[model samples]
Target: MKNPVPLPAYLALCLLLLSGCAAAAGSPGSAGPPSSASSSVASPPGGAHAAHHGTETGSPAPAPAGPSEAARMVCGDQPMDRLTAILELKEKPHTVSNWADSTFTCTYHLAEGTLRISVQQAPDEASARKYFDAMQALAKDAKPIEGLANLGFPAYETADGSAVFQKDSFVLHVDASALPAVAGPNAITRNALAYQLSTTILACWVEHH
Candidate 1:
């Protein structure tokens, strides 16, 4: 089978989160190990006919692709769906790309602009903070986001329209190219939305554990 196309960095992040959601939910397809982007898209169906010697003799079977079992446990087959519902978006959500079990990302088409949500695993709280710190330079009107580090996760928002935060063993990042009505004015809306999404995701992660 051909290798699956790698998703853009922003989209890839959403995919990673979706995959983690799948694993957390105990979905069988994504259970054993991290699945690559190719495996995610090219998965064979459950009832694929087998050739002698257990070889896939005919065309590859089509696997029912969606979020990993882990993702479903918290946010159903698509984590973005939960986000869209929260954002009260009118456009449909679609997966941009993903990596082997590590991350999942999706884009929500809106009149304002594309909104991307990425979720990834972090080794520790410190590691996630370090990563966030490094990206701080990009903040145009950088301001510390409140109520996150107090919970053991440090967070920040940039004037340029981005929000980042870490929680437990996961990091959440959000980028908005254009302002959505739901996000409100200035960074307030964007940061608030980021806070909401990160907290919700953290809650789900906690529930799974």
Candidate 2:
């Protein structure tokens, strides 16, 4: 070192060293604490993050209930179709159903008239027989139905074209009196219609049982 450096040159060299040190500190590869935004993570949409944590955000919907057993017996497709065919209806009848106090009733509104079917379920066979016998006794000019005895025990038709019968703990009544009278030679009467309807319902009961 023969000659000393000038004061301005020495100052400029010191400033260049200071700027290099500052650039190194701010470099992308430098080891430093992460910023607040860089350290935080965002969750996915539609509760997916909650699902990932094995948590239940909500419960699935429950399934709908089905029709009751008694309602199915009279209002089912088979019996309804049979009634439509027997009445010679151009279109399906409008139907109304009611269930109360162990009794199920279905009413069919046909083009010409109304047809009603009622089923009363007793606690036991004996109770059903007693109720049916009382009803039979109260009927005016009730006659025992010959062919349908096998379908329902002591089946009968009332003077008003209502068919009544009992099987086990069930008593069924079919009332077709509101229908118009059949006029043609081969036309079916209301009494016969009631009997046919009763047969169909009893067949359904046997199949299900």
Candidate 3:
């Protein structure tokens, strides 16, 4: 070799070469420096989030059920029709019904008077018979209605023109004290009308049960 290079000049040349290599590595033509990957994510469409979380979006709950068949029979349209036919009601009577203490009561308000029907449901047949016997014993001159024997067990007419009878665990009473008088002088009596109403109700019970 010719002349030896100075120490300072040699060190400067090495630093310049290192800087050029770094710039070339960062350029568009070369691979980029190390970095973290993208961290973003996309969501699903249309209530998919709710479905994923076990929820039904935009839906309503179901409705509750109505009254029982027995309650409807004791206080509904069939008996009303029978009352109209037997009493010859010119106008539709105003009606009200209630249920309490295992009993159902229905009252019809007419222009001339009121008609009432009551049904008591006991726990067992023995309890119903006991109650029926007690009612018969308490009636003011209770008389067994031979004609209504087919209607209920030991049917009877009360002193106040009502009919009381028992069948199975059911005790029924039809009070016709204020029924309107029919056109004929020999029209059916109130007691007979009570019996007729009881017969209609018993037929309904038999049909349903």
Candidate 4:
């Protein structure tokens, strides 16, 4: 079943920006416009092609694996330890919810308000991309986030301090009710914090991949 996104009020301002990402993803004619050029290789110039006639092509890279049981124990079922480290929160998350499916959710008490993080496992990359596209359709007024492009996937942070992205077969979300007045000693802003948290979770996906 397709999950309908119910974005919070703060995210309304991001709808316009993300709509394009979704549009681009769903466009049949668009395949690799924004994908990094480094990911592809150019064909060799030759008067006649002989390498393809009888040469053996190498095996493709292995398919990414699902999240590990250790990951489920560390973050999926109980994410407080991980969240606390990233947010520098004084108090651990007060709420935890592990759904009937593999969706793991946690809510933390912050100085300004609440911060919620949710992680859900999709069956495969296509399913994960479908959700990422869905979330992009719900964003507006977004700007390209710097320094996060090397995570082996497209990642973004919204103007409203929310971040959403997918890696492997996982969809990760970080939403803050309000940005902290002053980031803890480490000086991580709400948006950067979201990106950081997502990266950490994506590492888990990579480990199993």
Cα lDDT for residue 176, model 1?
A: 60
Residue 92 accuracy (lDDT) in model 4: 68
Residue-wise lDDT of candidate 1 within 134-162, one digit each (tens)? Answer: 55544567677654232445776665556
**lDDT at 143, model 4:** 52
Pairs of residues at least 3 apart in sequence or in different chains that clash in candidate 2: none
Question: Which stretches in model 4 have alpha-carbon errors above 4 Å?
Answer: 1-79, 86-91, 98-102, 144-150
CA deviation > 4 Å runs, candidate 2: 1-71, 147-152, 183-186
lDDT of 1: 0.45
Please name the candidate that would achieve the greatest lDDT relative to the true structure.
2
* Model 2: per-residue Cα lDDT over 75-156, one tens digit each: 6566677677755667787777764444556777776777888765554455556667766776777887654243336688
Position 153, candidate 4: lDDT: 72
Cα-based TM-score, every candidate:
0.52, 0.62, 0.61, 0.54
Top candidate when judged by TM-score against the true structure: 2
Candidate 3, residues 1-209, lDDT tens digits: the string is 01133334433433443332211111111112111222111112221121122224434222112213443454555667656765576666777765444455677776657777776555445555665666677677788765324333767776567888887666787877766533113365677667656766666555445
lDDT of 2 at 44: 23
lDDT of 2: 0.55
Clashing residue pairs in candidate 4 (N, C-alpha, C atoms within 3 angstroms) = 13-140, 14-139, 14-140, 15-139, 15-140, 16-140
Model 4 lDDT per residue over 97-201, tens place: 333233444455566676766544454456556556655655775554444243457565676677776766556777653767336666666775665555555
Q: After superposition, how far is residue 137 of candidate 4 from its true place, in Å?
A: 1.8
